[model samples]
Structures are given as C-alpha cells and as structure tokens.
Target: MNYEFTTVGALIGLAVAIILIIKKLQPAYSLILGALIGGIIGSGSLVTTVNTMVSGGEGMISSVLRIMTSGILAGTLIKTGAAEKIAEVIVEKLGEKRALAAISLATMIICAVGVFIDISVITVAPIALAIGKKSGYHKEALLLAMIGGGKAGNIISPNPNTIAVSEAFKVDLTSLMMKNFIPAICAVVVTILLSTMLSKKQGVQVTENDLEQKEDKNLPSFIQAVAGPVVVVILLALRPVASIVIDPLIALPVGGVVCALACGQIKNIREYAEFGLGKVVGVSVLLIGTGTIAGIIKASALQYDVVHILKMANMPAFLLAPIAGILMAGATASTTAGATIGAQTFAGTLIKSGVSALSAGAMVHAGATVIDSLPHGSFFHATGGAAGLEIKERMKLIPYEMCVGLTSTVVAVMTYVI
Candidate 1:
C-alpha cells in the first residue's frame, strides 16, 4: 500500500544484505533481516513489513514440512546401513577406475525417478563415503559429483518446478515431462562429467581417508537397502498410471517404514525421523525466510520495477529464460522457488511472444539451476554436512557448481538457439 519507496533504496538494501550474509550472520537471520531492510527502504511501514514476514514464513510451513519428512527419510536411510549397502554394490560393480562417476550417476538415477535432493543426498552421502573408503577418490570431488547429479535431478525432474509450470501454463504433466526428458538426460550427464572435472581442477586433493573399509555383505541386501527409496520413486511415478495422487510426504514415509521393517530398525524409527528433522532446521528456516523476503518484495515497488525492467531488457527468449531463473534462485536459494517464480513472471510472456514451451522450460530449468548452488543455499550447506567438512573446507565445492551451471546454461541456449 506504500507508494513512497524508491528503487535505488531497495537496491541498496539488497546489496548491503548480501554483504552482511557474506560476513557470516546466521542464514535465517540474514535473509529475514535483509528482506525487512529491503521492505523498509521500499517505503513499507514497520507494521506491514512484520505482517509480510509472518505471512511469508507461514506460507512456507507446508514446504518446510515436506522437507522435514524428507529429512526423516534421509536419516532413516543413513541409520539403517541401507544406504551403505547400495553404495557398496554400485562402487564394487563399477570397480576402482569408474567408482567416482558411478556414485554421481547412481544418485542421478535415484533423483531422476522423482526423489528430492534433500532426501536423496542424505542417503547417497553414505554411498560417497563408502566409495571414498573403497577407492581413494578425493572427498571433495566426490562431494561435487554427488551434488551435481542431485542438483540436476532437482532441476530437471518432474518435481515442484515442472509441476508448477504444467499447472500455470495449462500443459499436461506428461507433455512437460516429454519436453524436458532429453534436456534432463543431457544435463545430468554433463553435470556428472563436468562437476568431476572442475572439482579435480579446483585442487581437490585425494588425501588418504581413515575410514574403515568394511565389507558389509552380511548387512541388509542391496535390494533390501534400496527398497524404501525405490518404492517411493515408483509410487511417485505411478501417479498417472494409477490416476491417483501420490504425495512425497506420504510415499517417502511409507518407503521409510518398509526400509525400517526390512532393516529391522522399527524400534527407533521415530527417533531416527526426529534426528533427521533436527538436521534440516538450517535449510527450513532459510527457505521460509526466502518466502518472507519474496512476500515483502511483492508488497514493495520492487515487483513493478522488476517487471518493467524485464520488459525493457528485450533479450532473446533463450537468454531471458535462464536470466529469469538465475535471478530468483540466487536470491531465494531454491530452484523450485526460482523456477516457479520465473514461470509465474516470465514463462507466459515468453510463450505469448512465440517461444516454444519446451525451449522455455529447458532454459528456465537450466538457468534457475545455475545459481541454486550459491554458497549460502540449503544444498551447499547440505553437501557440507554430508561431507563432514567445515565451511572453509567446503569452499572447493563452488567451482564445480559454477561449472555445471555454466555448462547447463550453454546447453540450454544451444538447444533453444539451434
């Protein structure tokens, strides 16, 4: 309702916020306070600013809930030794030479089937560690490779972003999936190869790990270990086949239950789920804070100015598509947020301007993914946690992400341009 806000002030607020975040303020605090500062500079009153923050945080509870459930599933996999068994089999089958790439590819396969990175990474992490012990791969390279694959799946798969596009554009899910399938394949492959290369180039040293290289053949069978996540994937995919809705919140837990039953960890399943819940607070708060910031900006003069700038840029469809994705994703630290917001704001504009939905989708998917790997993001934090590295140690992770983002964007541009 305030009209007195200046564009320059809002921009200044955002810049200052980024500086503060880089200075290592808590992420939740940084993002929430940054949005508030921006809102105030944009001529919003303290009252309206507080309301927007509350509304934004409240709006994200459902998403946060899903993330928690995913955390629970991830924790269960870790605790059960189920994740270890699967990783062992994959690495053993691929042997020492190809083991690094195999871990990345395996995670990609799981994600391709519909699992979220938040869920897949925790489970796959054990695999990466297993591989590192089995073969002397650089811990950092393995981390980058695993993230690249999971990030690819997150960007390319039929999760929230594509689903949002389908609903908003009135396109069928099948149609959207068909359109994105090839791009997803190409992106996943490129993500694995390029991430590994870039990480190695970034001076990832393969120091000897001190992990016990235990052969757990007597542990749960690989098939049994994989049953939970595999079942979740199948249930998610069968949405159209069964013509019934399947929520990850429902499916993942069911699979978790099965995994617990199989691994015989049923007694502490609740405890395991609780442990998972604790791990995601960092990401969950940041996600909610992003929503809050987004709400405040929407309430400010920022949205109008952004829309006008978008109109004035007049860039090509391929360029603008990824640009749109990058902007939202960089600010929000979420590919789904970036993709959905970009689609809501620009996908229609592109479509109406004669760009094909398939091309537009690829560009958006790739573009949003480019910046979703920012150091402050949930994925970055998750990767660090998975690798048991300090924040400073995790710095090597960025170059690989930057490379993958660049590669995917180039591929999308080429796809659309050609």
Candidate 2:
C-alpha cells in the first residue's frame, strides 16, 4: 500500500511540477512544493511531512550556496571588467565586421573549455552583445550565432553536464566526442554561414542606439583576463593530476580565487571565500532539488520504467534524441536542462538500437541547437532583453534555426552511420 501510494503520488507530483515549470514558475520551488505535498498525501502523516521538509530544506540550502558562489564569481568577473577585457581581446583579434563569424569562433572556444550553458551564457552573452553592437550588426544575428556555438560545442566537449549524462548512461566522453566531432564541426560551419547570410538579407541598419552599447573602458589587464579562469579550467581538465593531491571541487574555487587575485581583483581573501560559498549554496540547492525530484521518481520506479518504454520503442537514435529534447525545450524553455536530460535518457536506447555513439550524441546536440532558436527559449529571452535586438521582431530565427539543426543532425547521422 505504501509503495502504491508513493508511486501514484510521485507521478502526480511530477506532472504538477512539469506543468508549473512549463508555465514559467520557478522549477526548484515548484518541485519541492509538489514533493512535499505528495509526501504528506502519500504518507498520511504530518510528522513524516515535517521530517522530509527539514531534510529537504537542508539539502536545498546547501545546493543554493553552490549556485550563489558560481553566480558571484560570474558577477565579480562582470564587475571587475575582466570578462569584458577577454571578450574585447577576442573580438579585436577576430575583426568586428565579421561579428557573426567571430561569435561562431567564441562559441567553439567556450564549448571546448567545457563550461555549462548556464554559466557560459552568463559569461558570454554580455560580450556577444557588446561585440555585435560595436560591429554595427544586428544583435539577433550574433546572439543566434552564440547559441549555435555553445549548443553544438557542448556535444563535442567533455563538459560536466554531458559527462554526468555519460556517466549516468555508461558512455565514454572521449570516445563520444571523437565520434561526434565531424557533425559538430559541420553544424558550426553551417550555422555560421547561415547567420552571416541572414544578417546580410535582413539589411539591418545599425543606428545610434547600437553604438551606445559598447562595453565599458575600465577593462582588466590582458594578462589578468587570460590567466584567471583558464587556470581553473586546466585544473578541471587535468582531473587525474588534481585528484591525486586535492579534491577537484576545492581546487575549482581555490583556483578561481587565485585567478581573481592574480587579476588583482580580490579585495580580500575572505570575500572570495564567501563568494565561493554562495555559489556552492545556490547551485547545489537547484541541483539537489532536481535530484530530489529524481530521487522520488526513482523511489517509485516509474521514471526508470518510463525510460525503458521509450527505449523499447526502438525509434531511430537520430530522431528520438532530438525529438525528446525539443519537447523538453518547449516545456522548460531551457535547452540546458532539455539537452542534458534528453541525452542521458536517450543515449542508452539509441546506442542499443544500433546508433553509433557519435551519431546518437550528435542527435542530442542537434536537438538543443535547434530548439534554442525558438523565441520561447531562455537564451532568446535573455539575449533579446540585454541586447535590444528587434530585427524583424521576436522569434524570427526559429525556422532558420530548425532547418540548420535538422540538416546538421542528418549530416551527423550519415557520418556516423557510414
């Protein structure tokens, strides 16, 4: 009876949470609320509900601290002007007249660095806006290019998100990237060409408004900009080396602070310490909240069963991964979540059903890239808000984005299949 009740209630809670998330409610809050309610109803006891709430609160608080640290680190980078300096250096070397092309390059670079899309966006979007405005190009074009770069690059890089998915599904990131490289590269190329052509056809005029959006001049020293974050990244990549001596998580914040100091941006060591704590709290809360939802579903055994059902459907890897991602993107308006989960869920089935690891991986990549072009995506909203892009109004790039992703996936499938 308890099993039946827990299973039934979890399904209900999941549905409620999904609907609320789709309706633009905060997912973390909605999920916890749904879980609490379900727990109470399923257990039919207030004491059990209270106990769960207390534990959940502790977990959420811890996770939120993590998120806040990453956020502050990001915020400080923006405030200290180091992030701007890096973007400026890259843009200057790349040539502003080719801003869209430049964006493609930046995207590839960031992706290869293995940054999560959420963090990557916070790091890159402002820079993309600054560059596009300087180049007198439509922000829309540049932003789309940025998304294209990050989404496809995610597929090719050993980013933690994909690494998590890989671990969850028992896939190897190195092998996956190796197999998926061609399609990912081809997608970036095609995306760049299309963006450039679209920028031309739109015949968008750069007015005075564009010039006003240039980045601030209080940029950090070039060396500070270069060394700060790069060191942390290298540390993460060299996990085998770092893990032999120190914990990677400890190393990341420590490295961030070291870079912050090297950049001469740290006012005090305590401040950096506090900032890291904040990020840990915030990110951990969100992730753990998500993990809780996952836990409840797992406890009920419904989520796994549902996954098996989808797997046994025996759909083509190229089609199923992207389609699932599209549905998730539409629901959550977040390609990060959509693509991450979609890849995890589909990877096993896709591989078992005869899809090469690389081909299947590309399908996941294609889904994220295409869905993000939709006007409803968080990237679209955030970029448009920050950049003031009004080229042919909102969501004008959807059709074009869809075509690019679809075509790119087809190419990826062929490359892997043959």
CA lDDT of each candidate? Answer: 0.65, 0.56
RMSD to the hidden true structure, all candidates: 4.5, 5.5
User: What is candidate 1's lDDT per residue for 1-418, written digit by digit as tens?
Assistant: 2433456545555565566666777656766787688768777788877787787567566656666666666667767767656656766788767766777766765555445665567667766776665565566777777777776666555455555445445554544555555555666677667655754554434434534354644568877888787777676667667767676567767777878888878898998788767766655666666566655644556545655676688754446677877886776566766665555445556786688876776677677777776775667787777777678868766766766766666777786777
Residue 326, candidate 1: how far off, in angstroms? Answer: 1.9
How far out, in Å, is residue 303 in model 1? 4.0
Off by over 4 Å in 2: 1-15, 33-76, 107-136, 153-184, 213-216, 240-247, 268-283, 299-326, 339-377, 390-392, 401-418
Alpha-carbon TM-score of each model against the true structure: 0.77, 0.70
Candidate 2 at residue 19, lDDT? 71
- Model 2 Cα shift for residue 325 (angstroms): 4.4
Q: Give the worst 10-residue stretch by lDDT in candidate 1.
A: 203-212
- Tens-digit per-residue lDDT, 337-361, candidate 2: 4454455445655676676665566
* Model 1, position 327: C-alpha lDDT score: 82
TM-score for predicted model 1 compared with the true structure? 0.77
TM for candidate 2 is 0.70
